[model samples]
Target chain A: MTQPTLGVWDVAAVSALLLINGALSVWLSLGIARQLLVAALRMVAQLAAVGALLTVLFGAASPIWTLAMASAMVLFAGYEVTARQTRRLAGGWGPGLGTATMALAAATVTLVALVGPLRPDPWHEARVAIPLFGMILGNAMTGVGLGLDTLTTAVVRDRAALDARIALGAPRFEALRPVIREAMRRGLIPVINAMAACGVVFLPGMMTGQILAGAPPGDAVLYQVLIMILIAGATGLGLLGAIVGGAWRLTDHRHRLRLDRLAPARPAS
Target chain B: MTNAEILTLRGLTSTALKDCNLTVAPGEIVVVQGPSGSGKSLLLRAIADLDPHQGAAWLGPLDRARMSGPAWRRMVRYVAAEPAWWADRVGDHMRHPKRAAELAVSLGLAADCLDWPVTRLSTGEKQRLGLARALEDHPPVLLLDEPTAALDDAATRAVEALLKRRRDDGVAMVLVTHSDAQAARLANRRLMIRDGCLRDAVS
Candidate 1:
């Protein structure tokens, strides 16, 4: 029964699919190509480095090092979101959104660790928990950036109403509640749609890969479903948390919105 | 003695308000007038501490730089020449619906305007909103920079009347305007700001 229906070459086939999709993305969007190329090259270098290290580390390294690496990944993800957005604005808003990234990654890791089957050694299973947590944070980071950009644009676009609020009796965040809510919804739509389309439009990469590696198809599908739910949950946390967490910065101590703090549009990139 | 001079600017220099020294007395309506770029509005901004100035500013007898930012701002409210906006609907700013209605009616604006988005409101209506904000907050002194420069005659009158009423209520007002008629309408004292200095009108 172990008649090797597919050789190691099958892994090559999967990687080829990743490249085709990446090339198609480049052809359709040059800007996306810039991001995708950086992401792809970085991913390969990191995964190869990790693979090389694992043979020795798993055999002898401390579990503490593995856990430390996970924490660092989450922190860096948060910082990445903050610096990327903050550099564009005048003040602390970028770091403020970084708080969203931290919350997102934490919630994902927490949910997986608490609800899923306990690994024989979670800290040691750097292979499983770290990758999964990272993927969730990465996706949620995209959603957050979209949501934050929308919120910033909406605030500026609606500046008159905002100024009037300070003129009136409304508090800063109180005045911006509606726009923030809308931006959160906008940022979340793509991720939610993906969740809904799962198993219908295409089998997700996690499930397909697991099945190819000799896991029962049903088992892989079950885990895939769980992961999808986790992703959606983490993204929701990121979108909602970011919208609320950052309201304080936008408003003055007297509860008035600070219009000058908004990031202006850059020369058309 | 002058209720501790709600706003005092010394050695104030700015593109908005050039080298100047002035005191805004408690409960007095003071209008600043000059041609554009003469720093009439800059005087108000310098007092409010919203713009950088070369000298010292005092709010209610406290050095502005010495006081905590929040404390200084609480004592002084700065209304820009172009009103700043951050909301979509006008009514949304009125956290209290009843006050919104009262303010809209008093400002010669329809109560339905509360429901209207800020985008739909004319420049004049928006200015009224800016003024309404300054008034609603009940700040001791109002630093207005050409608050009526962008308004129509009717809107202008409505705002002027409100300022007149506020002045009668003993609220100190710093009104920056090029229109002498506007200065005469509400200001008990019209100080001329020219060449980075404040002077009593020769007349």
Candidate 2:
């Protein structure tokens, strides 16, 4: 086996891909160059680390460790995504820390077993199952994080009018109806816009990767569509969690927005 | 609530307050006098429990600290010289009307001022709208901070006339004005804030 072709894995190739992504980073997220760089670095490290672990386990021909690693991947991705979104509303880190991990694990298991006909034994086919879950959950993490950020900022800015609604005999959640609607509007609009621009602007990463692996274009597109649907569903659920749960931070038990917490700005003198 | 919608402050010390004791009985007009930056407005806010101070302040039966922030403001109407403008329309005032059409009519404003956008309103119109908003609330304690500062002759006369009517109806008011003519025409209790202290007006 002629080293499986040096073209398949090369440092220069990877570096070139990173450089291109860095150059395009400005287009992806403006005014946040450092954040994009850090994200790219994280992506490289996380994928490479996982790739190495899987190779070692599979190379040793052990199925059990491979299955455990895949499970761990799903759990970790989900937990991190959920934690980032809900930490602010939970008021402290500990309450919503691992909830996302659980959500992701359940979604992954449900997708593999019930949603799709892909019934390969996870223990035997650890590579496919683990990486698939990683991509699925990773997309969800992004959507959820963005959704929560939008929701929090909107709530903070429009807090006065929002609280005014509450005082006018609107229920706490009812009072936040306008804000909640605006948050969801902002959260969903970006993803929908990107999806519209897909294919024409740039081949999605999943479809492109599939085509590079010599898969048929049509088949790759089909797979990408399925994955996209799953991601949207996951995103919707995650945003719902953020909107409903975050309502508590805006108001107390009596349906009054915490005004003492939002004291009017005082003069510096 | 209680008759004492405003918190009673005795010797309240803060950057916004001097050593002062203030009691605003229900249905009484108490106008505060001072030149610029003497903390007259701050004293009103302090009585409203909107200021941070060391002195004890009681609102009705509850301590100022204990009652919720929204509840406290609901009982006290504070019309700063420049009220916050969230929209461009005068009509949106009906969105949360504390009073009815009587005051709007009393101020010689057409009912359409209710529908008029804030952008279309003159400075005098906004001040009138602010006063109308305060009156709509019908709070037992009316805190006026330079209510006429932004007005021309006509708007000031209109506001003065409406305030007189409200006073006749026995709505308690705390008017903060630098104009002696304005105070002499409107105040039942005349107090001056000077160098962070409150005392009866010398005149």
Chain B: TM-scores of all predictions: 0.86, 0.86
TM-score of each: 0.72, 0.64
Q: Calculate DockQ per candidate and list them.
A: 0.20, 0.10
Model 1 lDDT tens row, A36-140: 668877987888787776665565556686667666766777666655552234556565565555555555555565446635454446566556766677767
Q: Which segments of model 1 are wrong by more than 4 Å? A: A1-61, A64-104, A107-117, A151-164, A167-172, A175-183, A200-202, A232-269, B1-22, B35-81, B84-89, B95-112, B115-117, B129-140, B192-203
| Tens digit per residue, CA lDDT, model 2, A1-269 | 12233454585567776666667867776556677678877987987886788788756655577557756765565456445542244434222522453355336544653335556654356556555666655665566555655556566677655643443334567677776776666656645765787788878898988877778899999888766666666656666665565565556654555434322332222
Name the candidate that leads on DockQ: 1
Ten-residue segment with the worst summed lDDT in candidate 2 chain B?
B93-102
Model 2 lDDT, full chain set: 0.64
Candidate 1 matches the true fold with a TM-score of 0.72
